[model samples]
Target chain A: MAAAEAAGLIAVGAGLAVGLTGLGAGIAEGNVGAAAVGAITEDASLFGKAMIFMVLPETIVIFGLVISILAIFVM
Target chain B: MFKRSVRKGNYAYTVTRVKAKKSHLLREEDYDKMIQMSVPEISRYISEAGYQKEMADLAGKYEGMELLEHATYQNMANVFNSILGASQGELATMVSAYLEKWDIWNLKVILRGKSYGLTGNGIKEDLVPAGKIDEAALDKLISLESIDDILNEYSRMGKVKFPADVISDYKESGNLGVIEDYLDKLHYQRLLDSISPYTQPTKIFLDYIRRDIDVVNLRTIMKLKSEGIYGEKVMKYYIPGGMQIDSKFAQLLANAETVSAAAGDMSRLDVFEEYIKPVLDFDNYDNKAVVSAIKKYQEDQAKKMAHMYPLSVLPVIDFMVHKETEVRNIRVVARGVNSGLGRETIKGLLVI
Candidate 1:
């Protein structure tokens, strides 16, 4: 019972961290994505490079999600 | 630090997206290449680059400087107006107030041009698309009989308010300086008072702006002093809003011939928060101090920007400023190339 309770609390903490950072990652990526799209719209050659940076911020959320999932199953 | 999760996803996303867009701006290589090219060649170069569609589209209606100006304004409008529409909450509130600054600038342009009796075409070229006013409204405003008419139209539409009545007295007094000061004070007051942020990002942004204002005031006082203009009459144009440019600062600025002298004489600040802290003895160097100080400010801004990855309000503002500087530099380059001017003169106009 003690172990279960501890795991539950840990899961909740991970969930909160994921939620916060996930939103942040989204917002952070959003700025770049819009800017990239804007620049690309002006210049098509810019499209390839812009697309890369736009997706770069998503790694944060992906990391957060992986951490949360790992915490749930392993930790 | 701005609270990433505290804000709406939509707002955060927009800021991030805009930040990415600022990265693709023309670098020094492009400008160097452009400098060696003719006007037509430059236009073609930009066409082959990012401005292809815009150049092709605007090619028919305009050519040369007109085309370039239109392209620049349209692109600026499309980018910034999108930012204005996309963001929500406090960030939106702050950016919106700052954007409305264009409205103030537009109004001034309208007023000054009208006062000078500029031709319609003359006034139109100077009007950048920085305000909420649409093209049609701007056309109508330009054709209006008086500044009062434009203000009245805005008031009637409930789109905005103008303190025309307050400005009227100053206008009648035959001192444009008073009217200009009144307009600036009211604009800054409304701008600063309306935007409240829960995040430190907001504070930093406002401090940056207020610091910019203080520098402008300090520079203005310096310029006036060098010209031997003094007394309460000339000082009436100066406002009291910016922190460092208070009474003591103003008095010292108005009195000192050089920056080092001013720094030595005034209550010395251990740190100048917003602007580049002037180097020791900068006060004594006559007119040259202003240029050095401005360069220092730019370098300081670059340092701050280097720490943060590209995105947020900073990038957007940075792009606009850089674009303006670029445009000014290009104009200098264009004129120099066409007229066979010295490289030093052209270099003076170019900012990094």
Candidate 2:
């Protein structure tokens, strides 16, 4: 019973690790994406550059995912 | 008590779009080339650039310098209207309020036109229609028969109201100077009152406007002082709420015996040293040169603020100022070319 409770707490921690970072990435990307789309509407040639900026925040979520995987499997 | 939340506008999108539009404005090289071109050639050049629609639309009615002038004005109106449309919430409110001067300008044009016995078409040519009063409403106002009728119609439709005794005052004095001064004051007063300074961006924006007021007051002081007007008489022309030119400073500047003396007093202030001092220090000061220097300083300050706060109204305001300068520059070039002025002379007239 004690082990089960500890495992459940670890699960919650892992969930939060991914969830909070994903939320942060989403907020960051929302701003970049809006600006990117605005620029793209004005000049279609900027699409590739805008896309690169739009993808920059995704790395944060990837980092969170790595941490979550380690917390669940390697721990 | 319920607290109202501070409403935010879509700064990211608006700023980005404005940046893109700003990039498309005429560059220094373009101005250099335009200086050598004839009026028709310049018109064609602009038409090929970004003003294709305006050029095409106005081509039927106007030609030569008039064509360029009308096209640039129409394009400016369209650009301002688009910015107003793209902005939301607080940004929209600020932009619309800033553009409200155009409304006052249009009304003054109509009043002046009516008094001068100008026809509707003649009056319409001068109107910009960039404010809350759109082109159609301006057309309707122009169609009105008399000055009183136009004023009545405008008061009903416009956001601002004419004084209750304005018509009577006009009749009594037969001078629109009183009414025109009242409108100018009303524009600045309304602008100051509408802004709340709720956020950092707003605080900076308010500071910019106060600086603008200071510039205007300084210009007025220089003009009045040159005319040998002083003290309380100068105070009548002063519009308050400047960043530096307070009542005390205004009085000090006003009481100066000459224009250079007034400028010397102004130079003691750090802010005025760069733009104001060099231009006004000499006797027989060219008003146009002083105005241009002030405009350049304002533009530089705006560019700095816009850089510091990218996702704010500063970028938009900067773009608007630059766009107006572009239109003005093009008009100068066109007019200079039409008047058979030399390239160097025309270049001197350009602000760029």
Per-residue lDDT for A1-75 in model 1, tens only? 999898989889789769988898876775676566656654578778877888888788778888888888888
Question: What TM-scores do the predictions have?
Answer: 0.72, 0.92
**Candidate 2 accuracy as lDDT:** 0.84
Write down the C-alpha DockQ for each prediction: 0.20, 0.80
TM-score computed on alpha carbons, candidate 1: 0.72
List where candidate 2 sits over 4 angstroms from the true fold.
B1-6, B165-168, B227-233
Candidate 2's error at B184, in angstroms?
1.7
User: Residue B338 lDDT in model 1?
Assistant: 65
Q: Write the per-residue lDDT of candidate 1 for residues B4-54, one digit (tens) a residue.
A: 533532433554455455565666777777777776776677666556666
Docking class of 2: high
Model 2 RMSD in Å is: 2.7
